[model samples]
Target chain A: MADLATFDVQSMNRVDLVTVSGRIDSSNAGQFDEILKGIVGKGRNNIVLEMNGVSYMSSAGLRALVSTLRTCKRNRGDLRLAAPSERVVDVLKLAGLNSMFSSYPDSVAAVGSF
Target chain B: MSQVEAVFPARFAEIARICALVQLEAAAAGFDEKEQFRLQLACDEACTNIIEHAYGGENRGNIRVLIRQRDGSFLIQLHDTGRPFDPSNFELESSRQPSADLAELQEGGWGLHFMHSIMDEVRFDFDMDQGNTLTMIKVHP
Candidate 1:
């Protein structure tokens, strides 16, 4: 079975922090989506996605991020990305998503942006 | 130099990892790193769509991927025994529009559009007896 590795979610300074490891593609993209939905469901809008441990991401992963961003905006919240690997950054740039979201060098910076 | 094949789950996560391998190998074959990443994103979108929509969310079938080099180009074929669906039927969204508005963006519906925009050539073959096959090609430019 193709697994999406693991994802850890926490809260800090009123920002919902999500840390994703491993790969995010078709199989596990939905799981990530559900996790984001759950967090948004709790009405926590300020969000930071930390991708330092992520080795790979597909367009499906990008889709999940976009979805989360949309949900945050709908609820008057914001989403930021932090510390993506070079490979992950490359995909974001190719998709032109790098410019669409606020990106910080680390989780602390990202959280502080809130 | 030659051809390679890998089979993985019809799940989204596995497809992403396999596509990453394809990008790495394609980059090593002299393709520009940017183009390589585009190919990886396109492949991931296509394969993930298959696993989700075509496979009926079963998540337990085999997805066969074939990578070959031909005529100074790289060819990838993805084969799955899922429901028959043609990717060519839908009109793809243009990549020219910036994803600026989070309200205008979508999560699931954009996969097909993303795949079509990045690949140089994409085609679909449906075999009632065999399965659905997606063939994509990227020429080194």
Candidate 2:
């Protein structure tokens, strides 16, 4: 069975660039949270999420993102979003979380923000 | 008017399938891409609430959904038989407010908030004989 979401992570000197593609809903949100936690657990706190391929995100997905963001910020680092789809941006706005994380238009900008 | 009904097992894995079904109906009802996306998110959160709160656990019960397109509005009624739950009891003030302080944030109630924000009308009704029903309506824009 093919997975509903996939995450590919590349570690940089100051940030971890994670390219994510697929739908993030209740079913796979736990998996998403675990993967992010794993990334932070390995002594990498700064994260740049490339979300060009994310087609959908529900409140459950937002929960995972919030949890990860809190963890990153606690370690004096941050989680930045790059190239989110329009739908994802709308969701973040509706959830009143658009101001929580700084968003960039592309991965280069997001990575450079760190 | 067009209508579609389906029963799904109350499991986390079934949320995407449910959303897909709603997406089809929403698109058929003349919802634009943005409205369809809102419907999908509302549907996803509603089903998740059923599985997690109404059923108390996954696979313990079933979620029956009815989608209807009528009179320039999209209507969704979700029925669950596991338990009677008043979702307002779990409402969090933080869900409606965006705060940068992590300590004051609450992650649980955003699902209900999303459902209410996306749908124009949201109502919950419970009957001893008919089970719990959550009816949500979105007016065509």
Candidate 3:
């Protein structure tokens, strides 16, 4: 799969902030899940996905987030969202998955929440 | 507007192209940015369902997509020569809603839910000649 989405991960003391930018669809959603799972595998379950740069996300992307969230919770950590665009938030709300993940206005607040 | 049709292999790689084409029609039909995103999301989920359920895998079949505009409605029809399936049944069979509870949320059922919620109308039909067809309509407001 091509890099329909790209991300840079910054490991904070209490959280790993991943700034993701691009379209997320069925084509690249598996890769997105793998990347997040890799971070969780490394014992960094507290994650904040900075998503203002994400222009689009489908159910496949949402599935990845759910799976990652479940894993994080099992490890006594969490996956949080930060600064998602209105479009992405609409999709999140449409799928009724918005409440599963906490949203922060900025990465600083997201990291502080952890 | 006249109906526009395109056929592509039932592969995950082709979903983006299929969605981009339909989005062009939706944009030309004067749908707003939010509506365009909704149309795109619905189309993406529909195609994903076809690939995963109807064809059962990628490269197993082809998907025929038809988009048309009439009155204030945008119509999207997806035809696949795979299996006879009903999307509503999938929704009915799944007892899970991801939003209902965080601890028990699962990932497999959101595609059909999004298609129904985002689109004004969603219907499924199966025919001997048509195989399986999923129709979705969005009204421009």
Please name the candidate that would achieve the greatest DockQ relative to the true structure.
Answer: 2
Instruction: Tell me how each candidate scores on DockQ against the true complex.
Output: 0.43, 0.62, 0.60
Task: Give candidate 3 misplaced runs (Cα > 4 Å).
Answer: A1-3, B91-99
- The lDDT per prediction is 0.77, 0.87, 0.86
User: How would you encode candidate 1's per-residue C-alpha lDDT over A47-110 as one tens digit per residue?
Assistant: 9999998766777678778888888988889888899877678777766678888889999999
Structural similarity to truth (TM-score) of each candidate: 0.82, 0.94, 0.93
For candidate 1, write residues B26-83 as lDDT tens digits.
9777887667767777787777678677887757598999988777888889999988
Question: Candidate 1: where are CA atoms >4 Å away?
Answer: A1-4, B6-9, B20-24, B32-37, B59-61, B93-99
TM-score pick, better of 2 and 3? 2
Candidate 2 lDDT (Cα, whole model)? Answer: 0.87
How does model 2 score by TM-score? 0.94
Better of 1 and 2 by DockQ: 2
lDDT of 2 at A58: 87
Candidate 2, A1-114: lDDT as tens digits: 223888899999999999988888888889888889999999899999999999888888899888988888889989999999887899889978888878999999999987
Residue A13 of candidate 2: its Cα lDDT?
Answer: 94
Instruction: Summing lDDT over every window of 10 consecutive residues in candidate 2 chain B, give the lowest-scoring window.
Output: B86-95
Model 2 misplaced regions, further than 4 Å: A1-3, B87-95
The DockQ of predicted model 1 stands at: 0.43
Query: lDDT per residue, candidate 3, B91-110, as tens digits?
Result: 69433455576776667778
